[model samples]
Target: MADLLVRGGTVVDGTGAPPTPADVRIRGGVIVEVGPGLAPAGGAERVVEAGGAYVAPGFIEAHTHVDGAMWWNPDLDPLPAYGTTTVVFGNCGMSVAPLRESARGPVLDLFCFLEDLPLSAFQDKVPWTWERWPEYRRAVEGQAVSVNVAGFVGHLTLRTTVMGAEASWGRAATGEEIAEMAALLDESLTHGAIGLSTNVFDKDRYLKPVPTRLAEDAEFEALADVLARHPGATLQLITRFNEPDNIDADVERFARICKPRGIRAQWTAIPSTVREDYLREQTIALHRRLRADGVDFWPNVPHKPLEPFFNFERALTFQRVAAWNHWINGPAETKLATLADPQWRARAREDWDNRVSSSTSRLDRPESLILAISETGHGPLGISLKEYADREGLHISDALATWIGHNGILSCLRGIPDAFDEPVVAGLFAEPHTLTNINDSGAHLQLFCGSGENVYLLTRYVRDTGLLSVEQAVHNLTGKLAGFFGLGDRGVIAPGLAGDLVVFALDEIEVRPEEKRYDNPDGSWRFTRGPAGVRATIVRGVPTVLDAEPTGERPGTMVGLVSPPN
Candidate 1:
């Protein structure tokens, strides 16, 4: 007597195998059987006719900033609907655990700044009842969510819990402080953290470096030693490889810490642009070297374009320039004053010019910056800055500034950079060591939407371009990533595995246009989209999404590494 039976679907079993017509039987939240004509045994409590669809392992979102979003929106909408069954949170050195009473305000503020999360969302929605890592895990587990969650103990949280505001202000921890942090990390892993996550590149909202950025080499080695003690514990790093010469050095540092310890290290945002071909090649070569030396170093790369839509009010575009930090972090009056100042304008122009020539700029040409939305007709509503500037006989920067001054906070710009070269991106996907991820789903809520990237890869890359076969893409999203993260019981359509599955029509798949929704706490607006072609997403043998809609059933639970069977 199976709890559920999915029949007549082509099963892509998440092992890079060719699809085969099969019937899957689920009982007691795990797959009981997968073969032809299994439903003939005749006692399925519920049967889903998945004819003309592909039944595959549900997606595992490898990187997300949904640490706080889970507290506010337990359903974690748009994710489950897009076929994500599990998500790894607390990325880029941000998490909501291991808090001290004194460090509460600073940690929340840092989270709000680094992830672009609204402070009101946390203050109004979260209860802030827990402090230690175990308590925090229990609190989140108590919540009702539609997708499974596996979180890393954040390095910033550990540092702040041990050293308080001194760590928040970029002060390097003392030797004793490092020992305390390491001990806490060990305890966190023992309690149930998936791994340890740290960021060496990100800065807080106030333009100050994150706590992990201030850590010395010895501190990182100490933390790695703690990770080494716990088998299957991973080290997630946001490497400071933005500069050319530093790439090899950063990789070597991570490899040194992870190699001898037999720990896996995963780094973020390997570039997919033509301009960064050199960086990408160097990264691949370095990964090969590390792998040959018996180090497991995986570089996470994006399957979609690294573009974000933003408004002048909260423009992450300008945040890259140090001169624009005050404007972004300050109040309206301060931003207005800065915009009005000639000295500030000159400095901003210089900074923008310098960034444009650097490897970090998202925009290749000013004309590619499209005005996505606007309330004022100061400039052309949907035209590029170059067109508006040429029409008004002004510099592009001046034209943008004038429009923002009149439109105020209501204008939005779509910063779609021409950096993502299709051939280079496909090549990266085909690479053996690269992990297809980097969807900053819960973060950048107002700026852009990356939640549908998993489906986007399937529709655009596999179905349309034929760059990657369905088998390879499914493996990339499921079994490969699940194995990397040690979620052993999921990410495969096999007997005794957790029955997290998705059934979707291959020909009809599509990612809808981005829409603005006022769904967050305090009536703040965030960009979202509806998904198509996905018929149903089942978590733990229960359908969380049916026919592209939430079924209001939360069968998801906290998942971690499974102990080896004796």
Candidate 2:
């Protein structure tokens, strides 16, 4: 007898096959029955009425940084709200393991920019009882996590663990160190991690407190070789050259390096743009080149807007040129002083005015910068920073500073003020080979209103925007994503598949601005209360979140890649 039954919903079914009306029967955490009308099997313990909502395999956050997120957040509600049932973390080569208990403090502080996790919230509060990945995994799994999570062994952890806080990006791994790093990575993978992760050119500087910048070329290659040894292991290459022109050469080199070794390599963060015709062409060339060489690669397309969030500590550093691009993780007073300096400001403005084109980084704040999504309470959700600052009688940087403190974080969702349309983005998505899994979730949490992006995709993109049909978008979110990452039986709604499912009110799905909920493991505060969705989301056939809150069921396991076919 099926343990649970979900009835009366149109199943989008994640396979891109086509949506059809159906009912699903769950038993022993597996989809035991799927048909037109399955009466409750004898002895069915529980029943859920889908109420004619969409019942599909839950979505995947192919890339996310939620290792600490699960712990600090009780409900584990963030991604599930967006229909995300699983996540691949430790992307961009940043992770918590491989560092000693004594060294975890600096590692957490380095990541504090993307997250304002006061030590008290996560570190100080949660007992640092484990030093190894297995130990860490057990501790976390022991808790109630509403979502299923799989992590990669990040190179950042290896370097800092082996070389201490002074780890730099350029230092070549020694013959001895190479083996040591590989051994550590192997251990993590064996313990349940998916693969090895690295960032050739991360957003922050090498010397900054972050771990991405702390490895040499030799070190990365050695890490690659380790991945090669594990057949089904995939590579998530977060590189400096994410643009088309630069992306090709770097991706080509990576493909060449990984192709022969039977490793899959993919670059991140191809943002949406209509005017950048040449850039899209370059991206296609790179994709085609990798495919032609029998190398597996795909883009983690972030068609969504780019809005980073940070606390006063790091927001102040954004004003200075050297500190902005370079690494600047230090005490609070030093950061504030750097921003206040007139000479520093001059250098920063010059750097911004001359480098990293306004096209990609939105550096120049052109006329094209429109009001996308603002954090202002009463005024507007999406407004041009320049115009808003001008009217408010403050510089853009100053307003950002003031707003961040006032709002707990200044959020901006900017767009390509001109010539942007859905069809162009649909074209990017149509390259089904390019597995869609690039939502910068949890990173820009404080600054961006992306918590409801999945809703936006469902309602706006699929239903109204018409970029793709519900089947197509669901494929991008489900099977296509799982296919790229090689999550064998998941992402498809079938008899043998794990029942990680989401039921949502289609039209009601949305991104909403919630009042700041100051609940952090640390005594500090960060913008909380993400857009609520997921009338019901189940992980491994267990109800983890109901009506958008954790139900205290942790059915998630660390996933690993087995050796591939010879």
lDDT of each: 0.79, 0.65
Tens-digit lDDT track of model 1 for 1-566: 12788899999999889999999988888998999877444555578788999999999999888887887888887888889999999887777877777887888888787777888888778878888778877887788888999988888888888898765476888999999888888878888888898888767766677888788889999999998888778888887766677777877887887788888878855777776787778877777787788888888877776556766555445656667766766786677667778897788777666663446554436676777676676645778877777988975666677767766666777766545666667776676667886788888888777788899789888899888889888888998888888778888899989889999987877877778899888788888887655888888888888876878788877787664222
Number of the top-ranking candidate, with lDDT as the measure = 1
Q: Report how far off residue 65 is in candidate 2 (Å).
A: 0.9
User: TM-score of every model?
Assistant: 0.94, 0.84
User: What is the Å distance of residue 403 in model 1 from its true position?
Assistant: 1.7
Candidate RMSDs in Å, in order, are 2.3, 4.4
25-112 per-residue lDDT for model 2 (tens digits): 8888788788888887666457778875888898888877776776777465456666667888887777777668655765676555
User: At residue 556, what lDDT does model 1 achieve?
Assistant: 76
